[model samples]
Target: MSVWEFFVWFFWFYIVISCISIFIRVIIDVFRDPELSGWAKALWLLFLVFLPFLGAFIYVIVRGRDMGRRGMTASREAEERIDDDIRSAATSTSAVSDIETAKRLLDSGAVTPAEYDALKAKALRGTA
Candidate 1:
């Protein structure tokens, strides 16, 4: 084939692949959405199966904005959950270590009983 014909075919191939990718992504997102009822999801899937191109096009046109918003919200919630978990773990470990160090210091006569008590309270309160 001529170089021009090859380029034409490659362009069409890219378009087709892009459409298919978008369709698959949308379908997955539909399934992932907790707000969509079972019947709604089933209807969407049926439409997509029966009329692939037009169904995908209309779905995008109608629900595209909400789809993007939901995706972003999900991502943000995941990040927040991860951050909370990290903070919880760090604080627990830090408090334990701090209390242990204070106990060691008290045993070695480096701190008075009053000082150890204060340090222990601070560690337990997670502010040490």
Candidate 2:
């Protein structure tokens, strides 16, 4: 093919691939959505399957705002979950260390049994 022809083909190929990727992403997102009912999901899937390009184009045009919102919501939720997990792990490790230190003090006679109990309770409460 001539250089010009090759460039035109490449441009078209890029556009087609981009459209297909968007379509697949939307389909996956539709199924992942908690707000979409099973029937609604099924109808959307049917439309997409039967009408590929038109359906994808229309879906993006119609639901584009909501699609963006849902994507942001999912991303925020995932980030929050990861943050919670990290905080839980850090808190647990700190609590364990605090309790261990208290136990060592009690064993070495630096702290009384009552003092050790209080420290343990404080550490546990701090974690919670």
TM-score of each: 0.68, 0.71
Candidate 2 Cα misplacement greater than 4 A, ranges: 1-6, 94-99, 107-109, 113-128
- Per-residue accuracy of model 1 over 9-121 as CA lDDT, tens digit each: 99999999998898898898889788899999999999999998998888889988888988899899999999999998875667778889999999999999999999999
Residue ranges of candidate 1 with Cα displaced over 4 Å: 1-6, 94-100, 111-128
- lDDT at residue 23 of model 2 (Cα atoms): 88
lDDT of each prediction vs. the true structure? 0.91, 0.90
Best by TM-score: 2
> In model 1, how large is the Cα lDDT of residue 39?
100
Candidate 2 per-residue lDDT over residues 66-119, each given as its tens digit? 889888998999999999999987756678999999999999999999999999
Candidate 1: C-alpha RMSD after superposition: 4.4
Model 2: what TM-score? Answer: 0.71
